[model samples]
Target: MKTNGKKTGSGRIAYRKRDRVAYLYLLPWLIGLVMLQFFPFFSSLYYSFTDYKVTGGMNWIGLDNYIRLFTKDADFHNSLKVTVLYTLYTVPLKLTMALAIAMFLNRDIKGINLIRTLYYIPSLFGGSVAIAVLWKLMFLDNGVINAMLTALHLPNIQFWGDHRYALKTICSLEIWQFGSSMVMFLAALKNVPKELYEAADIDGSGKIAKFIHVTLPQISPIIFFTLIMQTIQALQNFTSAFVITNGGPLKSTYVLGMMLYKEGFAYFNMGYASSISWVIFAMIVVVTLLLFRSSSAWVFYEDEEK
Candidate 1:
């Protein structure tokens, strides 16, 4: 009994020593999470309530910044409206184009891999500053696009200068990068059971009917995921608006991101910018919650049916 007790005690000590080593390995990540991510995240929240400046130090201001945003900020209202319009235009169009292209590419054809790689190239480089600059140049009055128009005897368009086309042009830049969403949809499509399509055909279902019933229900989960992701992305759009139009000829493409940038860096209203960031965060949270709530109605799970 004495020897057994000694062995047990030594085993406990060894276990503890192993645990300590494991914790030592995790320490760096824990420190990074606390100092880099969590610290900055919560600090921004606290800063939102104060009159924080880059160099003037923090001053407690309560809800004055938020009050101004709700009551007197015309630019805020315009930015919000433009952002909603941009989201409305981009999300559905991008998803539809992605799904359609994905369906087309879900076949056994020669050079299909090369075609998919070609399509996905845009997504790989779409969000870069270079792509935004290229988009800007393409739409310029005397740019390649206009040169093509000249060949066809069509008039040149002031794409960047005109309010009517500025936001739309930016939306086109976003929609042009549907390759990522297309890949997701393609993966989902490939996973769909061939038996289901066979069953639909046996029921005398047409192509459209099979798509509506079999394809849509099977792929609804991917649709839901992409919908949420794309919506969040659209809400926080910045690169295209900033680099392409610079908030535009008349602030027509001024999204919340541009507004946040201008307030935070350009004007040095750090407190107000923090508030805007929090607002953007809240909007994302609320929108995400709503999507979750709505998912049950449309998103299909094969396990649930089983």
Candidate 2:
């Protein structure tokens, strides 16, 4: 009995030593989470409840900023409208284009890898300031697009200077960066079983029929993932509008992100900006929840089949 008790004690000591080593390994990550992610998260929440400024002290203000946002801020309303419009225009078009290209790339064709790489290059630089600046230059009144139109005896279009075309120009930029979604779709497409297609063919299923009945069902989960990710991305888009249009042309391209930036940095309304940030966070959470709720009806999992 004494020997057995000693053995058990030693085993527990060894287990504790192992646990200590594991905790040591996890220490850096825990530190980073608390310092970088969690601190900012809770700090923003606290800031939202105070009248914080960039260079001055803060006083407790409760829900005043949030109330002002809904009641008095016309710019907030306009920015929200523009953001919703941008998301509505950009997300579906981007996903559709990505899926179409993914389908094309899924075909067993020569030089397909090279073509895929070429197509994917735009996404690598899509969110960069340089690309936004380049896009701005390209859409200028006498820029390449307009010059080509002029050469073809077509009238010049003010892509950046005109409100009608400014937002659409930004949407086109977003759509052009569909490579990430395309690659994901391509991966999902390849996972679809060849036997399914063969069986469908035997059952007199045409190309469209096979796609609808087989390909779509197999890739629906990926589609759902891309939809949620792209929606979140579209809502948080700021770099292009800031670098390209500066939310100009009558603020037609002003998005919620830009509003957040202006309120936080430009105006030094940190408390109000914190409130906006929380609102954006809440919006994202609600949208994500809605997607998750709807996903059960559409998104198929391998485990579900079992």
Which candidate number maximizes TM-score?
A: 2
Tens digits of per-residue lDDT for model 1, 160-212: 99999999988998999999999999999999999999999899999999999
TM-score of each predicted structure versus truth: 0.90, 0.92
CA lDDT of every candidate: 0.91, 0.92
| Candidate closest to the true structure, highest lDDT | 2
Instruction: List residue ranges in candidate 1 displaced over 4 A.
Output: 1-25
Q: What lDDT is obtained when candidate 1 is compared to the true structure?
A: 0.91
What is the Cα-based lDDT of residue 97 in candidate 2? 96
Q: Which stretches of candidate 2 lie over 4 Å from their true place?
A: 1-19
Clashing pairs in 2: none
